[model samples]
Target: MLDRFTMPLTHRPLASMARYLSNRQVTPDQVTLVAFLVGMSALPLLAFEYYVLALMAILLNRLGDGLDGALARLSGQQSDAGGFIDIGLDFVFYAAVVLGFALANPGQNALAAAVLLFAFIGTGTSFLAFAIAAKARNVERPNFPQKAFYYLEGLTEGTETVIALVLFCLFPHYFPWLAGLFAAGCLITAATRLWGGYWTLR
Candidate 1:
Protein backbone atom coordinates (compact mmCIF):
# COMPACT_ATOMS: atom_id res chain seq x y z
CA MET A 1 0.00 0.00 0.00
CA LEU A 2 2.44 2.62 1.24
CA ASP A 3 5.38 0.75 -0.28
CA ARG A 4 5.51 2.77 -3.46
CA PHE A 5 5.73 6.07 -1.63
CA THR A 6 8.00 4.92 1.20
CA MET A 7 10.38 3.10 -1.11
CA PRO A 8 11.49 6.18 -3.01
CA LEU A 9 12.07 8.14 0.20
CA THR A 10 14.10 5.29 1.63
CA HIS A 11 16.11 4.48 -1.47
CA ARG A 12 18.61 7.35 -1.31
CA PRO A 13 19.69 6.73 2.27
CA LEU A 14 19.87 3.03 1.70
CA ALA A 15 21.85 3.57 -1.49
CA SER A 16 24.35 5.73 0.37
CA MET A 17 24.87 2.97 2.94
CA ALA A 18 24.99 0.43 0.17
CA ARG A 19 27.75 2.35 -1.56
CA TYR A 20 29.74 2.38 1.64
CA LEU A 21 29.26 -1.36 2.14
CA SER A 22 30.09 -2.08 -1.46
CA ASN A 23 33.39 -0.25 -1.02
CA ARG A 24 34.03 -2.55 1.94
CA GLN A 25 33.42 -5.55 -0.34
CA VAL A 26 30.25 -6.64 1.45
CA THR A 27 27.99 -8.98 -0.51
CA PRO A 28 24.24 -8.52 -0.73
CA ASP A 29 23.78 -12.13 0.31
CA GLN A 30 25.73 -11.39 3.48
CA VAL A 31 23.43 -8.52 4.27
CA THR A 32 20.41 -10.71 3.65
CA LEU A 33 21.77 -13.38 5.98
CA VAL A 34 22.46 -10.82 8.65
CA ALA A 35 18.96 -9.46 8.30
CA PHE A 36 17.53 -12.94 8.75
CA LEU A 37 19.63 -13.55 11.84
CA VAL A 38 18.64 -10.24 13.37
CA GLY A 39 15.00 -10.86 12.56
CA MET A 40 15.19 -14.37 13.98
CA SER A 41 16.65 -13.01 17.19
CA ALA A 42 13.46 -11.06 17.69
CA LEU A 43 11.59 -14.34 18.04
CA PRO A 44 13.22 -15.22 21.35
CA LEU A 45 12.88 -11.68 22.59
CA LEU A 46 9.20 -11.73 21.88
CA ALA A 47 8.87 -15.10 23.51
CA PHE A 48 10.45 -13.68 26.64
CA GLU A 49 8.15 -10.66 26.50
CA TYR A 50 10.98 -8.23 25.84
CA TYR A 51 8.93 -5.92 23.69
CA VAL A 52 11.31 -2.98 23.34
CA LEU A 53 14.32 -5.11 22.47
CA ALA A 54 12.30 -7.14 20.01
CA LEU A 55 11.11 -3.92 18.39
CA MET A 56 14.68 -2.78 17.92
CA ALA A 57 15.60 -6.09 16.32
CA ILE A 58 12.60 -5.81 14.04
CA LEU A 59 13.65 -2.34 12.92
CA LEU A 60 17.24 -3.39 12.31
CA ASN A 61 16.00 -6.41 10.39
CA ARG A 62 13.98 -4.16 8.11
CA LEU A 63 17.00 -1.87 7.69
CA GLY A 64 19.11 -4.78 6.59
CA ASP A 65 16.38 -5.92 4.23
CA GLY A 66 16.30 -2.55 2.48
CA LEU A 67 20.07 -2.08 2.40
CA ASP A 68 20.78 -5.47 0.84
CA GLY A 69 18.87 -4.60 -2.32
CA ALA A 70 20.55 -1.23 -2.52
CA LEU A 71 23.90 -2.91 -2.02
CA ALA A 72 23.09 -5.41 -4.75
CA ARG A 73 22.26 -2.65 -7.17
CA LEU A 74 25.31 -0.60 -6.17
CA SER A 75 27.67 -3.53 -6.71
CA GLY A 76 25.89 -4.73 -9.83
CA GLN A 77 25.66 -8.10 -8.15
CA GLN A 78 21.90 -8.57 -8.18
CA SER A 79 20.77 -12.02 -9.16
CA ASP A 80 17.70 -14.23 -9.07
CA ALA A 81 19.40 -16.44 -6.50
CA GLY A 82 19.98 -13.54 -4.12
CA GLY A 83 16.36 -12.40 -4.33
CA PHE A 84 15.13 -15.94 -3.85
CA ILE A 85 17.10 -16.42 -0.66
CA ASP A 86 16.15 -13.00 0.65
CA ILE A 87 12.41 -13.49 0.26
CA GLY A 88 12.45 -17.06 1.46
CA LEU A 89 14.25 -16.22 4.68
CA ASP A 90 11.98 -13.23 5.19
CA PHE A 91 8.92 -15.48 5.27
CA VAL A 92 10.53 -17.68 7.87
CA PHE A 93 11.43 -14.68 9.98
CA TYR A 94 7.86 -13.44 9.84
CA ALA A 95 6.46 -16.79 10.91
CA ALA A 96 8.95 -17.10 13.74
CA VAL A 97 7.90 -13.77 15.21
CA VAL A 98 4.26 -14.77 15.16
CA LEU A 99 5.13 -18.04 16.83
CA GLY A 100 7.12 -16.19 19.42
CA PHE A 101 4.10 -14.10 20.34
CA ALA A 102 1.97 -17.21 20.56
CA LEU A 103 4.53 -18.83 22.82
CA ALA A 104 4.64 -15.81 25.07
CA ASN A 105 1.03 -16.32 26.07
CA PRO A 106 -0.57 -19.27 24.45
CA GLY A 107 -3.86 -18.90 26.27
CA GLN A 108 -4.43 -15.40 24.95
CA ASN A 109 -2.35 -15.10 21.81
CA ALA A 110 -2.30 -18.58 20.26
CA LEU A 111 -5.56 -18.39 18.37
CA ALA A 112 -4.88 -14.96 16.98
CA ALA A 113 -1.36 -15.91 15.98
CA ALA A 114 -2.59 -19.02 14.26
CA VAL A 115 -5.13 -17.04 12.29
CA LEU A 116 -2.56 -14.45 11.34
CA LEU A 117 -0.14 -17.12 10.18
CA PHE A 118 -2.86 -18.63 8.03
CA ALA A 119 -3.48 -15.24 6.50
CA PHE A 120 0.23 -14.98 5.83
CA ILE A 121 0.02 -18.21 3.90
CA GLY A 122 -2.71 -16.71 1.77
CA THR A 123 -0.74 -13.54 1.02
CA GLY A 124 2.54 -15.31 0.49
CA THR A 125 1.15 -17.87 -1.91
CA SER A 126 -0.82 -15.34 -3.90
CA PHE A 127 2.22 -13.09 -4.25
CA LEU A 128 4.54 -15.86 -5.37
CA ALA A 129 2.02 -17.48 -7.65
CA PHE A 130 1.42 -14.20 -9.39
CA ALA A 131 5.12 -13.64 -9.69
CA ILE A 132 5.57 -16.98 -11.45
CA ALA A 133 2.82 -16.33 -13.96
CA ALA A 134 3.96 -12.77 -14.48
CA LYS A 135 7.43 -14.06 -15.23
CA ALA A 136 6.12 -16.59 -17.70
CA ARG A 137 4.21 -13.85 -19.50
CA ASN A 138 7.12 -11.42 -19.29
CA VAL A 139 5.10 -8.89 -17.36
CA GLU A 140 6.83 -5.62 -16.61
CA ARG A 141 7.10 -4.21 -13.07
CA PRO A 142 7.51 -0.49 -13.52
CA ASN A 143 6.78 0.08 -9.83
CA PHE A 144 9.41 -2.38 -8.67
CA PRO A 145 11.81 -2.77 -11.54
CA GLN A 146 14.69 -3.52 -9.20
CA LYS A 147 13.12 -6.74 -7.97
CA ALA A 148 14.54 -9.92 -9.46
CA PHE A 149 11.07 -11.45 -9.56
CA TYR A 150 7.79 -9.91 -10.61
CA TYR A 151 6.52 -7.51 -7.96
CA LEU A 152 2.85 -7.71 -7.02
CA GLU A 153 1.34 -4.78 -5.17
CA GLY A 154 -1.04 -5.64 -2.37
CA LEU A 155 -3.17 -4.07 0.36
CA THR A 156 -0.99 -5.56 3.07
CA GLU A 157 2.46 -4.94 1.78
CA GLY A 158 5.81 -4.73 3.58
CA THR A 159 5.12 -1.32 4.99
CA GLU A 160 1.78 -2.29 6.42
CA THR A 161 3.12 -5.50 7.88
CA VAL A 162 5.97 -3.69 9.58
CA ILE A 163 3.57 -1.20 11.06
CA ALA A 164 1.41 -3.97 12.40
CA LEU A 165 4.41 -5.73 13.90
CA VAL A 166 5.54 -2.56 15.58
CA LEU A 167 2.09 -2.14 16.99
CA PHE A 168 2.18 -5.69 18.31
CA CYS A 169 5.38 -4.96 20.19
CA LEU A 170 4.28 -1.61 21.52
CA PHE A 171 0.91 -2.82 22.67
CA PRO A 172 1.56 -6.36 23.67
CA HIS A 173 -1.72 -6.55 25.51
CA TYR A 174 -3.50 -5.82 22.26
CA PHE A 175 -1.72 -8.44 20.20
CA PRO A 176 -4.82 -10.51 19.66
CA TRP A 177 -6.86 -7.60 18.39
CA LEU A 178 -4.06 -6.21 16.25
CA ALA A 179 -3.24 -9.60 14.78
CA GLY A 180 -6.88 -10.20 13.92
CA LEU A 181 -7.17 -6.85 12.20
CA PHE A 182 -3.96 -7.35 10.30
CA ALA A 183 -4.96 -10.85 9.32
CA ALA A 184 -8.15 -9.48 7.83
CA GLY A 185 -6.09 -7.02 5.84
CA CYS A 186 -3.82 -9.79 4.64
CA LEU A 187 -6.77 -11.81 3.44
CA ILE A 188 -8.07 -8.82 1.54
CA THR A 189 -4.66 -8.41 -0.03
CA ALA A 190 -4.61 -12.06 -1.06
CA ALA A 191 -8.04 -11.89 -2.64
CA THR A 192 -7.22 -8.71 -4.53
CA ARG A 193 -3.94 -10.15 -5.74
CA LEU A 194 -5.68 -13.28 -6.96
CA TRP A 195 -8.30 -11.27 -8.84
CA GLY A 196 -5.73 -8.86 -10.26
CA GLY A 197 -3.46 -11.62 -11.41
CA TYR A 198 -6.26 -13.48 -13.14
CA TRP A 199 -7.50 -10.39 -14.95
CA THR A 200 -4.02 -9.26 -15.88
CA LEU A 201 -3.12 -12.64 -17.29
CA ARG A 202 -6.40 -13.06 -19.12
Candidate 2:
Protein backbone atom coordinates (compact mmCIF):
# COMPACT_ATOMS: atom_id res chain seq x y z
CA MET A 1 0.00 0.00 0.00
CA LEU A 2 2.84 2.36 0.78
CA ASP A 3 5.21 1.04 -1.87
CA ARG A 4 4.52 3.93 -4.24
CA PHE A 5 6.15 6.25 -1.73
CA THR A 6 8.85 3.86 -0.55
CA MET A 7 10.10 2.10 -3.69
CA PRO A 8 11.66 5.20 -5.21
CA LEU A 9 13.60 5.77 -2.01
CA THR A 10 15.02 2.24 -1.91
CA HIS A 11 17.42 2.77 -4.80
CA ARG A 12 18.51 6.32 -4.02
CA PRO A 13 21.66 5.60 -2.05
CA LEU A 14 22.31 2.11 -3.32
CA ALA A 15 24.54 3.18 -6.17
CA SER A 16 26.64 5.41 -3.96
CA MET A 17 26.98 2.67 -1.36
CA ALA A 18 27.87 0.23 -4.12
CA ARG A 19 30.68 2.48 -5.30
CA TYR A 20 32.10 2.81 -1.80
CA LEU A 21 31.91 -0.90 -1.02
CA SER A 22 33.44 -1.80 -4.37
CA ASN A 23 36.34 0.53 -3.81
CA ARG A 24 36.84 -1.14 -0.43
CA GLN A 25 36.80 -4.59 -2.15
CA VAL A 26 33.93 -5.89 -0.05
CA THR A 27 32.14 -8.97 -1.40
CA PRO A 28 28.37 -9.28 -1.56
CA ASP A 29 28.45 -12.77 -0.11
CA GLN A 30 30.56 -11.53 2.77
CA VAL A 31 28.05 -8.78 3.48
CA THR A 32 25.22 -11.31 3.41
CA LEU A 33 27.02 -13.61 5.85
CA VAL A 34 27.78 -10.80 8.25
CA ALA A 35 24.20 -9.59 8.05
CA PHE A 36 22.93 -13.10 8.77
CA LEU A 37 25.10 -13.33 11.86
CA VAL A 38 23.94 -9.98 13.20
CA GLY A 39 20.33 -10.91 12.50
CA MET A 40 20.68 -14.26 14.26
CA SER A 41 22.15 -12.65 17.38
CA ALA A 42 18.97 -10.65 17.72
CA LEU A 43 17.16 -13.76 18.98
CA PRO A 44 19.16 -13.78 22.18
CA LEU A 45 18.56 -10.10 22.77
CA LEU A 46 14.83 -10.74 22.68
CA ALA A 47 15.12 -13.82 24.85
CA PHE A 48 17.04 -11.89 27.50
CA GLU A 49 14.21 -9.32 27.62
CA TYR A 50 16.37 -6.60 26.21
CA TYR A 51 13.92 -4.89 23.92
CA VAL A 52 16.17 -1.90 23.34
CA LEU A 53 19.06 -4.17 22.52
CA ALA A 54 16.84 -6.03 20.12
CA LEU A 55 15.88 -2.78 18.45
CA MET A 56 19.53 -1.94 17.92
CA ALA A 57 20.10 -5.41 16.56
CA ILE A 58 17.22 -4.90 14.15
CA LEU A 59 18.80 -1.74 12.81
CA LEU A 60 22.19 -3.40 12.47
CA ASN A 61 20.63 -6.36 10.73
CA ARG A 62 18.85 -4.05 8.31
CA LEU A 63 22.13 -2.36 7.50
CA GLY A 64 23.64 -5.71 6.67
CA ASP A 65 20.63 -6.62 4.58
CA GLY A 66 20.83 -3.37 2.68
CA LEU A 67 24.57 -3.65 2.22
CA ASP A 68 24.51 -6.98 0.41
CA GLY A 69 22.56 -5.54 -2.49
CA ALA A 70 24.73 -2.47 -2.59
CA LEU A 71 27.80 -4.63 -2.50
CA ALA A 72 26.42 -6.75 -5.32
CA ARG A 73 25.79 -3.73 -7.48
CA LEU A 74 29.18 -2.33 -6.59
CA SER A 75 30.99 -5.53 -7.53
CA GLY A 76 28.74 -6.49 -10.44
CA GLN A 77 28.30 -9.81 -8.69
CA GLN A 78 24.55 -10.03 -8.39
CA SER A 79 23.35 -13.60 -8.80
CA ASP A 80 20.62 -16.04 -7.86
CA ALA A 81 22.83 -17.22 -5.03
CA GLY A 82 23.17 -13.75 -3.55
CA GLY A 83 19.49 -12.97 -3.89
CA PHE A 84 18.47 -16.33 -2.40
CA ILE A 85 20.72 -15.95 0.62
CA ASP A 86 19.56 -12.40 1.26
CA ILE A 87 15.88 -13.31 1.17
CA GLY A 88 16.34 -16.48 3.21
CA LEU A 89 18.07 -14.52 5.94
CA ASP A 90 15.26 -11.99 5.84
CA PHE A 91 12.59 -14.62 6.62
CA VAL A 92 14.60 -16.09 9.45
CA PHE A 93 15.23 -12.70 10.98
CA TYR A 94 11.55 -11.82 10.88
CA ALA A 95 10.66 -15.08 12.59
CA ALA A 96 13.23 -14.49 15.29
CA VAL A 97 11.77 -11.10 16.11
CA VAL A 98 8.33 -12.59 16.66
CA LEU A 99 9.85 -15.37 18.69
CA GLY A 100 11.59 -12.77 20.82
CA PHE A 101 8.31 -11.10 21.58
CA ALA A 102 6.85 -14.44 22.64
CA LEU A 103 9.79 -15.16 24.89
CA ALA A 104 9.50 -11.76 26.48
CA ASN A 105 5.83 -12.20 27.34
CA PRO A 106 5.20 -15.91 27.48
CA GLY A 107 2.71 -15.71 30.27
CA GLN A 108 -0.13 -13.85 28.58
CA ASN A 109 1.06 -13.40 25.01
CA ALA A 110 2.10 -16.83 23.79
CA LEU A 111 -1.11 -17.46 21.85
CA ALA A 112 -0.94 -14.18 20.04
CA ALA A 113 2.69 -14.75 19.24
CA ALA A 114 1.93 -18.18 17.86
CA VAL A 115 -0.81 -16.73 15.69
CA LEU A 116 1.59 -14.12 14.40
CA LEU A 117 4.10 -16.81 13.56
CA PHE A 118 1.51 -18.83 11.69
CA ALA A 119 0.53 -15.79 9.71
CA PHE A 120 4.14 -15.00 8.95
CA ILE A 121 4.91 -18.49 7.76
CA GLY A 122 1.74 -18.76 5.72
CA THR A 123 2.07 -15.37 4.10
CA GLY A 124 5.76 -15.83 3.44
CA THR A 125 5.14 -19.17 1.75
CA SER A 126 2.46 -17.69 -0.46
CA PHE A 127 4.73 -14.82 -1.43
CA LEU A 128 7.69 -16.98 -2.39
CA ALA A 129 5.58 -19.45 -4.31
CA PHE A 130 4.09 -16.70 -6.41
CA ALA A 131 7.46 -15.12 -6.98
CA ILE A 132 9.08 -18.37 -8.03
CA ALA A 133 6.29 -19.12 -10.46
CA ALA A 134 6.45 -15.67 -11.88
CA LYS A 135 10.17 -16.01 -12.34
CA ALA A 136 9.82 -19.41 -14.00
CA ARG A 137 7.25 -18.08 -16.41
CA ASN A 138 9.57 -15.31 -17.48
CA VAL A 139 7.13 -12.74 -16.24
CA GLU A 140 8.31 -9.28 -15.39
CA ARG A 141 9.44 -9.96 -11.87
CA PRO A 142 7.30 -8.10 -9.40
CA ASN A 143 9.33 -5.75 -7.33
CA PHE A 144 7.80 -4.82 -3.98
CA PRO A 145 6.54 -1.74 -5.77
CA GLN A 146 4.62 -3.84 -8.28
CA LYS A 147 3.06 -6.01 -5.64
CA ALA A 148 -0.18 -4.20 -5.10
CA PHE A 149 -1.19 -7.62 -3.83
CA TYR A 150 0.98 -8.60 -0.89
CA TYR A 151 4.06 -8.22 1.31
CA LEU A 152 4.95 -4.68 0.25
CA GLU A 153 1.45 -3.40 0.85
CA GLY A 154 -0.11 -2.79 4.29
CA LEU A 155 1.99 -1.99 7.40
CA THR A 156 4.54 -4.80 7.13
CA GLU A 157 7.31 -3.37 5.00
CA GLY A 158 10.80 -2.79 6.34
CA THR A 159 9.94 0.75 7.41
CA GLU A 160 6.75 -0.11 9.26
CA THR A 161 8.32 -3.15 10.84
CA VAL A 162 11.10 -0.92 12.08
CA ILE A 163 8.53 1.43 13.54
CA ALA A 164 6.84 -1.51 15.23
CA LEU A 165 10.22 -2.63 16.50
CA VAL A 166 10.68 0.78 18.08
CA LEU A 167 7.21 0.65 19.51
CA PHE A 168 7.82 -2.81 20.90
CA CYS A 169 11.00 -1.66 22.56
CA LEU A 170 9.27 1.34 24.06
CA PHE A 171 6.21 -0.56 25.30
CA PRO A 172 7.01 -4.23 25.48
CA HIS A 173 3.84 -4.59 27.50
CA TYR A 174 1.82 -3.91 24.38
CA PHE A 175 3.39 -6.81 22.48
CA PRO A 176 0.17 -8.78 22.38
CA TRP A 177 -1.78 -6.01 20.69
CA LEU A 178 0.98 -5.43 18.18
CA ALA A 179 1.22 -9.12 17.39
CA GLY A 180 -2.52 -9.27 16.70
CA LEU A 181 -2.34 -6.31 14.37
CA PHE A 182 0.62 -7.81 12.54
CA ALA A 183 -1.21 -11.10 12.17
CA ALA A 184 -4.18 -9.35 10.63
CA GLY A 185 -1.94 -7.63 8.16
CA CYS A 186 -0.25 -10.91 7.31
CA LEU A 187 -3.57 -12.55 6.50
CA ILE A 188 -4.53 -9.73 4.24
CA THR A 189 -1.16 -9.86 2.52
CA ALA A 190 -1.45 -13.60 1.97
CA ALA A 191 -4.90 -13.39 0.42
CA THR A 192 -4.01 -10.53 -1.83
CA ARG A 193 -0.88 -12.24 -3.12
CA LEU A 194 -2.68 -15.50 -3.77
CA TRP A 195 -5.37 -13.75 -5.77
CA GLY A 196 -2.89 -11.67 -7.67
CA GLY A 197 -0.83 -14.70 -8.56
CA TYR A 198 -3.89 -16.39 -10.01
CA TRP A 199 -4.68 -13.47 -12.24
CA THR A 200 -1.12 -12.86 -13.31
CA LEU A 201 -0.09 -16.45 -13.81
CA ARG A 202 -3.29 -17.68 -15.41
**For candidate 2, lDDT tens digit of each residue in 8-57?**
68665766776787888889888888878887777888878887778888
**Which RMSD values do the candidates have, in order?**
0.7, 3.0
lDDT of 1 by residue, 1-202 (tens): 9999989999899999999998899999999999999999999999999999999999999999999999999999999899899899988989999999999999999999999999999999999999889888999999999888998999999999899999999999999999999999999999999999899999
Q: Which stretches of candidate 2 lie over 4 Å from their true place?
A: 142-155
Residue 138 Cα positional deviation in candidate 1, in Å, after optimal superposition:
0.9
Q: Which stretches of candidate 1 lie over 4 Å from their true place?
A: none
Worst 10 residues of 1 by lDDT: 144-153
Candidate 1 clashes: the total is 0
- Candidate 1: pairs in clash: none
Worst 10 residues of 2 by lDDT: 145-154
Candidate 2: the clashing residue pairs are 1-153
